[model samples]
Target: MSGLPAFRPEALEQWLPRTLQNHYVDLLLRRIGMTRRRADCFVRLALYLFLKNCQSRKELPKPPLTELSFPQGWVECSCLEAADVFYSDRDRGGDRAAGMMLNKLVDLGLIQKQFDGNCTQVKFHAMPDLLKSDAKNLHISFAIDAFDPRSDAIPIANLLANNYNWLNRNNDAVTYRIANILRDWASQYTAGLRVLRRSDNQNPVGFYAFYPTKRESEVKFFEPPSRGLHLSQVADVDPFQMALAGDETCRSLFVRSWVIDSDYRQAAQMELLLDAQQTMKKMQQDFPNLWDMYTLIIHPSYAELSLALGFQKTNADPKMPLYWMYQAVDRFLKLDMQNLMRDAQSLN
Candidate 1:
């Protein structure tokens, strides 16, 4: 490692002027979705792992190629060394920042890391390069429409139970149970939205399900319930729990689920957020009583995303790794989502 990049700040600085502008930045924005500055930080670490991993892949049998494949990868390094690669000495504090970035990268599906004694084993999974034909197209690449429970239920059930992408972050078993319960309570969903891939493949890629409720019931979501209404313990809002009929009054929304394919989320989130904003407008137009939205989050990636979108974690449970998150309709509308998401690579 003498002549090559050796996980040092100076070593990485040498290539930044040339490589960071093109290859690294574009991929981080297109594949990982980050602000230029944050992408710059992530790219440095990515380059170090990628190049060093390449040096070690000389004899290993290459795996079959696919969408999110890296031709040469995997490296084991001390947390301190990774810290040096990600942040300069002036800004980084030993291994703490390194650990945070590593967790974020793993959550983003950029790299998979496992702790091994004092060091970490890192495996690079290149984000899919399927956008080559229209590489310059920055528009939302997927389509969205009202989620049809009849056709999308099975797919939603499958995603909730079987998607390796989400299950990896949250436990596989927890989601499997959640999937079944979500299916059983499908009728409880007041509004649902589904995502579709571009071109001819019409299979559903993701969905966002919601439950509208009256203020009396909405209070439990903002406050910690004694029984603790985690996603696993959530129940349907009975007819009495429904908000009173109004010609055009404000009502609250309980987010049942916001599941998007891991592949589609990195690129489509901004557009989807914009779509959601419009959807709220339409919902308010129809319901006239659309108030605020809230939900319990167990998935780490979704938690980070909900945080970035301005969802505040209520005093639900300090001991638990999960809790309820809340956001008002007006607050979401007031947000500059495009700007908020640019630097949200870490949160995403």
Candidate 2:
């Protein structure tokens, strides 16, 4: 035990998003039908253990095999200690709460676990499959659409509520503000929103919302004040202004909000990216001035995906939680279109 790395509970609490923490709890309760208390404790403790392992991996000089295979890998920890930290009763029904929760998570196909002597090794297996399935479902028709506020409002609102509620935990103020922004964009015909709906029920599973801007003032209309600090740290002058500066011939499309439900996240992300590429093409044709795309990405997973798609972070602040990333539209458009077409064909 002395040779193995120690778990840091504080790091897990600090790095994990409140929205994601709640999401895990909701998933366990809805999927496995666990009681609220048990589900909360189970998810909290399990995620802490998982993140602790991830932190340990980061400290190592070489990457773990699981990291190579999965986007978010797994961790191994002491089941007894995990239970002692999360549950009041160290033993629940003679099996212990940690053991019972681990069993339930394994049964639900959310995690894979193996006993290695006294320690338990666990890994996540859902996100990769979700991503592949989403990519398979991509179609040109669903890539971009004219958003209808009347019919699309409820589902879009629900999606936003689930993903961004942590920003304003006290009420639905964030949801309302976002709804108003979407309505404004739809009404003005200045922007569009792409939604990915479930195949069976047609309920929206994910969405990507964005709008174009030519002036620095326009950036403020899209982003909240809380995000301004990160943007300020990244640029001595206004970053958005700098991107648009001396480019009288082009405009920047600001990616305001993007999210996918936990169950279909990876697939939704692929679909969203595919749709965004198509949308860019359409925007280029309709609005020839559209020359670049920029966004302030807060989530690490989103930042990783954006970087993979050729977005470069502008901010030099090593400590900033958010990233201001951008990509030139015209320079990459031709190659991007070719790749997108190839990807679409492969999916077919």
Candidate 3:
């Protein structure tokens, strides 16, 4: 876990903006599982140094006398200073704390290091792709039903509040609004919600709430105010637009909320899709007029996955932060179910 001592420059603080460093550190912490507080501090300091020194430079400076192998990119830091700054004990146990953290990080494939005299050279491994399957096995279960505001609403609200950090709403306000919306959906009988849970512990991990509508008036509460003209109200001469204007023939389902927890995100997404497919099949059987489904996707990863699953970008404003993606019900149903199984195999 120790590395050869390379050149230690004096001014490393000005290398990166504080905001960028904090963002990178937050992302790294979320991605990896680190338990000990001292280890976490050491890792953060090492990451800061690595980002400031190694990643910012196009090429690393020349190493000292000894020839060393840096398979991944590396940064040189004074061991004593790093320990004093990051570890709890500055005098006696700082070095040991730093060593323990570095070794743990190495074991986790996050970094590599070498020890030389009194200094340590640490190399940062590149973050692996999101689709790269980890060894942890995931077992997700699905449930689809009409929304029950009294019981299901609170849990669903809590799930979204916990998982969707981008949403800026107070917990109580979010829960209240979600409950009211669910109550409205339940009363209308035109919408349903799906919940995904871990099979082993039966804990909820994901949710998808949707409502079918053919005209703007049918969508009572959750209609976006920015959508000035509903599909039925458009006076455009386009044949497709005209077709969608039909009273009951061209129904569209609006996705109100869709989210999955971080740990089960990969496996649970496909499960949610499959669950949606089944739910759509039931909706089609009961309603017999549903045509397509649409959702505003905020996360880049979810947008990419949506595109991979045959969703198309809608004609909504391109400048918007969230992308509006749509998929025909038939096409969605036609997507290869075997792919889900293949993807789940990787999870196991």
In terms of lDDT, the best-performing candidate is 1
Task: Note the Cα lDDT for every prediction shown.
Answer: 0.59, 0.54, 0.52
Clashing pairs in 3: 2-113, 2-114, 2-115, 3-114, 3-115, 4-114
Itemize residue pairs with steric clashes in candidate 2.
none
Per TM-score, the best of the predicted structures is: 1
Off by over 4 Å in 2: 2-144, 166-172, 216-250, 316-320, 335-348
lDDT of 2 by residue, 152-195 (tens): 76778767666543334444254565566567566654344777
Clash count per candidate: 5, 0, 6
TM-scores of the candidates are: 0.72, 0.51, 0.51
lDDT (tens digit, per residue) of candidate 3 on 1-348? 123133222222234344543444433332323333533454445544653464446555432312111234556655555664464333355666657766656654456678777668777654433212222533335444445556666777676655434433334465555555556556655345676766666556677766666554334323342342221122233111211222465477766567776555645555577777888787776557777777666544355456556778765543444556778888888878557434423330
State model 1's lDDT: 0.59
- lDDT per residue (tens digit) for residues 228-331 in model 1: 34344334433224443352443777776676666566656666778778777766765676767877775665766787789898766656555777788889
> Cα RMSD (Å) per model?
5.6, 14.8, 14.9
TM-score of 3: 0.51
Q: Which runs in model 3 stand beyond 4 Å of their true positions?
A: 1-147, 162-172, 217-250, 340-348
